[model samples]
Target: MERTGGETLLSLTIMSEYSETSSTETFSTFTGLGATSGKLIKRVGTVVVNGVDAILIRRRLNQLEATLGVWSYSTTDSEYVKSLYNDLLELSRPVYKPPIRLRALRLIMGRIEMMRFEDLATAVANWPISYSYGLLKTMILCFRDTLPLIDMSVGIERTEALVAYHYTGSHRAQKPEHCAAFLSWLGLTTSLSTPVFSRVLLQLDILSFVTEIYPTDDHLLRPSAIRFPRQRLLNALLIGLEPVNDAVLINQVHRIRTIFVWARFLNPPI
Candidate 1:
């Protein structure tokens, strides 16, 4: 039977709609499996893609850097930062080539440059610290064979300071093993400058003090603790050690030393 012209057009429209929807879903599913995989496959599928892998990786890395930088500097949008970091996990998937992995490492390091340690510590305090650490460790391991390709001192310093700050703010018992491992890593790297070492040491001391006060069961910094005068003393210990060469700092250091001696004698341990 010959179909009417109107009926034939209607059938064609319906088929077109179905085809469009199906194609959209198929593409979405392919990408949803993993951005890394989808991107790599697309590049490999073409003979003239022209460094498509580097292009895509660089784009994602730039985005990740900007997202984290804004999150750090803005001091808001913890949820948004959390989602972005979560989404970025796609790049770390195992299927990517070594060069791709290397780019991922470089991106990770790039992102670290924008980190505000205090802000990030508070932002992810309640979330699992292991997730952040694991991602960092993965990037570090990926670049292990090509260590000469990147300068890791900056990243390592930032990671140590961040880990120390995060643990201190977390109000949990300081993990000695974790601290030791960080120290070991630092030793393996080029020696940190005096100021950097001093700052990290102070952070570690703060971590120890925090653990002592709150112990393992408590996970929140109490207002009473913050208001305590000892906290000020601890703050003085850290901030006063900055490499500023000023008479005020000299006096402040002298003052802190004097106060420490008197406090030690006056508040002798029971």
Candidate 2:
């Protein structure tokens, strides 16, 4: 989540465009332009998806309309819009290296109170497992606040929050494969009926893999896109390993051999 200190200037500037004109009315409402005005919006053009541009310029334009608008600086709408813009701005940075449309999708979600992620959901279905991993990570983080609503009780908030941290990172070599695979692995094999923790425990295998490979400097652990990001991978390991037993860690590493094998994460990407 974005801690405060977001870019207030730009947010203020954008909102000022729709600010009041020193009028006597305490509030001002702009009826918005005609549908033809859609032509005036700028396209975000060609967000990288799997080394190929996702060609989402059109949808990007639509998002700009819904999320960004002129508003008076001191009005109720303006403050809310400003806050939404700041969050969208946070999601826009390339530090995460996510696909542009994916980021925009999150930004749009951050602004709206209730919505479904239909557009990105469709785009990710055909994506490679690696790309899907990235998209999933962003969704989890953007919606991390909503975990309580989904839970029958709020007791496992910490545990649910941890799953959202699993899928995002810089390199395939360094990325953690904790979300989809872990969820699937537990769903199929577990007979315990309630495997919420199992959902998280399945990821311990990957947790152990990184611990083994990062220290050994081995070439057998490279995933094509799995190059590591310092903050992301480090923190993920820190969280995942907090509950680990040294002996259990050894067995866990052995369990996720297939993920590492398929990822071929050991080979360095040239």
Candidate 3:
């Protein structure tokens, strides 16, 4: 029988609490005692049905599990891993509805949550709309908390807080901007264009953004266009603003001129 999302999570939770130290456990302990320590990991199979896609998902999950095994887990780390697993399980739900959405929100809002950024990114790509809907809804909930609920106001402050609270970074160098890139990718997937998304997109490397969001089209955003601030042109790309359009070409020309003008003023007659 195909395992339900809830079943998958329950099984993982039980496995994590396994007390009997078997041969595999001994091997894990030995591996941890080595020069390089390890993180707790559970073997998870693909939920997708397509054979080729399932193979890809399995391979990716293995890669993530391998990488996760390199990190040492404390009580807090273990909790974070559990939260991530649960979050993904919720995101993996095949039939997204109000009940699932509420469950996802309750988990997110009930506590400060954490997850592997890469895993979250992978889920954003691989999960079904129902899952994505829940994930995005949870994000929106977090975003709500950051703003003053007095007038029902939400802004970048709320956005930053949400990003910080959820995405604690998979590595040292992971920053708000990288989190933004992940969101930008998610936004592209879910058609969620907002001020927060734009802010995040602006902070991402142009090539990285294009490659992840518009992989097949390397030439979507021109070098000249990218030299301008990301916000100035991000909407154009997201909105499918045709480069061949006379108005867009004219705007690009004007933007390039403005950049040159600013450069000249900043370093006049060096």
Candidate 4:
């Protein structure tokens, strides 16, 4: 069906690839506020989103960004800054491509430029943190053919980061060991398997930090392209690091299973 407003129509064709649901519960609550969700509803221009119908969705996206920015701005009157931030990420499932997607990110940045969460600087502050995610995202984009998210970032640290980690090997040219090269290039890896308690969405905290990161949910891991020893590439996070308790190890195993499921979903032939 088509969900339209004025001249544009939103394609409801978003399937499992584009799970039209927020990955976070709090994010959904914020987006559900209707018009209070901000300016993610307007189309800045002809944003060529691949999966969903590009008409109404673009406008909705713009409104979403505006709403998030306004809500999260420290001085903004809205009392839901944290609530809205979570919502924006939750609504990020149908995240757009560069120039287009950049619009929303800029809005988020504008709102939170002066803010820091949990006393830790923003993820956008450091490139290693962001690049690791970006590199992961790039590989995901390759798998999904989703969208180009190569915008390095802005600031001195980002500049230093780009210089140090701008590019290294033949990760893109399909050379031998590209997968190994890429993962090794990433240095320390973070888990993206599932959400943890208390911390909500910590990216890389191992001690008492609950995050749902790992290869399972991340569509761009390129599991097929990565051909290392099963225990090394597949269970790198667990095996590479110093051995932990059996309970934590068991949790990691469960998350790995999630990755296998998604990989199979992406490439059924495997």
Winner by TM-score: 3
Model 1: which ten-residue window has the lowest total lDDT?
A: 184-193
RMSD of each: 19.1, 17.9, 13.6, 16.8
lDDT of 3 by residue, 1-270 (tens): 245454332333333333322213454322322111122222223232233223323333343244343333333454445434443344234333333323333333222223223434443444444444434543443433223534335343234335434544422432333334334444343233333332233333332433343222212323323233333344433443333544543354345435545654664442
lDDT per model, in order? 0.38, 0.33, 0.36, 0.35
Clashes of 1: 0
Q: How close is candidate 3 to the true structure, as a TM-score?
A: 0.29
Better of 1 and 4 by lDDT: 1
Off by over 4 Å in 3: 1-23, 26-120, 144-270
Q: lDDT tens digits, residues 10-98, model 4?
A: 33333321343323324433444333223222231223344443433454556555654443334343445544443343233223444
Clashing pairs in 1: none
lDDT, residue 259, candidate 2: 50
Give the candidate number with the greatest lDDT: 1
TM-score for every candidate vs. truth?
0.28, 0.22, 0.29, 0.28
Candidate order (lDDT): 1, 3, 4, 2
Task: Tell me the lDDT of candidate 4.
Answer: 0.35
Error of 3 at 39 (Å): 15
Q: Candidate 1 — what's its lDDT?
A: 0.38
